[model samples]
Target chain A: MRAEEPRLDAAGALAFKDHLREAVRDAPPRVVLDLGAVDFLDSSGLGAVVAARKFVANGALELAALTPAVARVFRLTRMDSVFTIYPDVPQAIAG
Target chain B: MPRERVRFRADLHAVRDALIQLERGAVLGPLTGESRSVILLVLAEVMNNIAEHAYRGEGGEGSVCLWRKDGAVMARIVDRGLPAPAIPAATDTPNPADLPEGGFGMPLIRVLVRELAQSRRCGCNVMQLCVDDDNAA
Candidate 1:
């Protein structure tokens, strides 16, 4: 799913988690998050991403096309090494 | 640097807006893309840590005083919440096979700022953060 916001704060993060949880409930074996437009991500936002990861099926969650800002959050927290990140949505879909 | 203190609620948007305004008020060369990112990430993590741990998720009112001094952006944040821990140690990253969530706030803040001092005075959490202007990503 593509995020449409410039910043994803606490409230937005929780809402994203809920949406992802619901999506995971009925999603395919693989779920990819398209964070192309999100420019600002905080700890709460990262937490939401992790929560979503835990909720999805094993080896199912993927993140694609992260802007530099969003990518930094994951990298700084060492989460970039944890999540299955893709260069873009197309590759994620293909893989 | 202003002698006057600028205060804002401890909510996410409020803190973020305040930081943006502070950045605009500075006359120095705009922070590099990496520097700006580090500053924002640090502030956001600290603020959320305050909201979650200090205020028990209430996100109570907090105050921020920012000024440019000696080519550094210095800030004193005061929150009417519990005393902050001496240092919120970074937890070990979970194994890839069993990744965990919700433990990156303190670690991120500790890494981004040049200096961080957290203390509890008068039953409040007082934190001082110093970010050098010349710092790069």
Candidate 2:
């Protein structure tokens, strides 16, 4: 469970994306992105999630646990259906 | 027509809180479920842009106003900061593939609102957004 609060901009988006990649690099087959602390997100943040989904799709890794605001972005773009969303870290990992 | 106005420093969190207040105050009353979600998304994106880009995160001041006239919920965001770039000509549909994390703000703002107008007046960038509940029906 790697958590990051990068500056709220493109740099922050890229940092989160890199964190997602690093978390799944060892092929753990399961990952949970904890966005509870993320107060703001934009389209770039949405793209990072999409990128993470593509990265995890290659293996048995699972990505879940999107915060409400983060989940809202996925839902707004209709990408929530594409990614399995859980409410929290424990739930995501348990599933 | 009297309008409700709220002013705050250019803080991302403050902008979001103000939006939540407006949403709860019946500005988007007729919109429920998915429709409400659309309004929230658009509002957050635009407010975030103003805080991040327009004000450059330097803590400038801005005002948000919401007015209900007829069946439409109208909102105007005015910021005393750098002027935003002109609204792009092609705004109806945003290309998800070519979207940059930062540049997608204006495009998303355009699609989320029923109507959008942007201009620079008195050294302030004013963004006008409107949503008609009747259209959602």
- Alpha carbon lDDT at B77, candidate 2: 85
DockQ per candidate: 0.53, 0.22
Chain B: TM-scores of all predictions? 0.76, 0.79
Q: Supply candidate 2's per-residue lDDT for B20.
A: 60
Model 1, which residues run further than 4 Å from truth? Answer: B1-5, B16-29, B88-97, B134-137
TM-score each candidate.
Answer: 0.84, 0.65
Q: Which has the greatest DockQ?
A: 1
Q: Write the per-residue lDDT of candidate 2 for residues A1-95, one digit (tens) a residue.
A: 54566223333566777877777776665556666666445676676766665566442334455555455565555555555667777787778
* lDDT for each residue of candidate 2 in B1-137, tens digit (9 for 90 to 100): 54667786687667756766665655554555445555656666777677788888888888888777776668888988888877775654334444323355566666556778898999999988887654432
TM-score of chain B of 1: 0.76
Q: Point out where model 2 deviates above 4 Å.
A: A1-27, A30-44, A51-95, B1-3, B29-31, B92-102, B134-137
Which window of ten consecutive residues has the lowest lDDT sum in model 2 chain A? A2-11
Tens digits of per-residue lDDT for model 1 on B4-69? 355767676677776566545553226666566666677777776676677886668887776667
